[model samples]
Target: MAKFSVSLKARLFLHDHGKLLLLKQTKPNGGNYSLIGGTIERKEFAIQTLIRESQEEAGIELSEDDLELVHVLHKRSAKEHRIVLYFRAYHYDGTPESKELEKFENVEWWSLKELPKNLTGTVRHVLKAYNAGLIYSHLRK
Candidate 1:
């Protein structure tokens, strides 16, 4: 029997002025714009994972005071059989830049008015939920 494990993931919405920072994934399963996020390590808190992933992937280091807890989502993928804890950050310091990650191809800033059409599924869903005033943990399945 395949056991399902709930995976906690953190995402940062690193917004500056009115634009939001997004990254372009480049890997075996690469795709368009998405937030700066990654999986939480073993025994690591969501907040810690958020900060760590932000710096590792986006090259931006942020403190607890620099981020606001926008949402926590329960995203489950049937294929992977894992739960993802989604988070968003509205405040932070320093500029976001692309690091030397082969998984990421490019980085760009997009405003709320202008979002790429080729965005990933998760990114699309999160944006919709945020706009619908839904910024908290919710079960996907």
Candidate 2:
């Protein structure tokens, strides 16, 4: 049987200029850029997890009013299952920085039209979904 787990993720959209913020992880898994996100703690609501991760990973504080649920994607890896809750933030304070430098190298903003070509498959899928205006939750093989 496959091990199942719940992973919470949120993508930060900066303003209405069609730009997205991303972080480049360092060490262990360096040079890979991904959204600002992490796993959800047990018993934590998905929205709460989104807020927590934004603060932890990017130092951005998000409230319910500041975010809109985009989608929930079911992703499965070789060893674990993930329920990724994606969100779009229209309002926020503070700049994004690599608070966890030991694991995160840098944070930068990429225009939607100029996303890095080397994003992981999962990231690519999310971006495509967002661009296509299909934010509803879905299962991924």
Candidate 3:
């Protein structure tokens, strides 16, 4: 078997007034909460993916300069391996409206201290890294 190359993902770390933005998943990858983002498209930079995904999933606009690369996580599971680029965003345009209704229930804000328990493993690891001020992490399943 050939070893596959690492895939790229873009994730948004959006927080405001002591709360973090999250999406309640629906199926296939449901029952777990996660930040708004997606797989990076071909020929697009991770930053571009961040901007695009934020708009697509959350109905908000983000700029390249408005996002800072805070963490780069190398995560591996039995079936998939990828590099998740986490961008810390301090500003966004308007509130996140409900999009991808079939994939996710709704986008909501949760206090850091009162976050939903069923967060995706990826999200949990990412958040933990953020809280710990880590710039990089390697998680394995």
Candidate 4:
């Protein structure tokens, strides 16, 4: 048996009506739409990470009471193994904008039924699972 390193991420599914909040990254960063979130820090919990990430990446403020854990994904890519926690929040403070200009270019709302063609693969998979009332899913690449 061998030991492996796994990264943990916390993502937000901030939505209203039938729309979701998504970020468009600069070309150097991937040039695709993705959720607002980041890696969980060494001393932070998933919820705490989401709270901090929401503020830093999108200028949206989230409280512990505003978030609900909607899905968990175990993803194994060629580069790394990761466990991502997706939180759904219909309530938050401040209008969402791209605060990290180096990584993201635009902050936009998209209809769930008409998602952009450039949406990230991971986001698409997670959203499908979440919408299907799944709490956990696995993906390998």
Candidate closest to the true structure, highest TM-score: 4
Q: Which regions of candidate 1 deviate over 4 angstroms?
A: 79-83, 137-141
Q: How many clashes in each structure? A: 1, 0, 0, 0
Q: List the residue pairs that clash in candidate 2.
A: none
Q: Model 2 reaches what TM-score against the true structure?
A: 0.83
**lDDT by residue for model 2 over 1-141, one digit each (tens)?**
656755555455544467778888775885778887776677777678778878888888788888777766777666666777777887787888878787788888888888887666678887788778876545556
Instruction: Tell me the spans in candidate 4 whose CA falls farther than 4 Å from its real position.
Output: none
Per-residue lDDT tens digits for candidate 3, residues 61-116, read 99888999999899887777899989988789978976887777789999989989
lDDT of 4 by residue, 1-141 (tens): 556779999999999888999999999999999999999999999999999999999999999999999999999976678999999999999988999999999899999999999999999999898889999999997
Model 3 scores a C-alpha lDDT of 0.87
Ranking by lDDT: 4, 3, 2, 1
Report lDDT (Cα) of residue 56, candidate 4: 93
Model 3 scores a TM of: 0.92
The regions of model 2 sitting more than 4 angstroms off are: 1-16, 77-79, 136-141
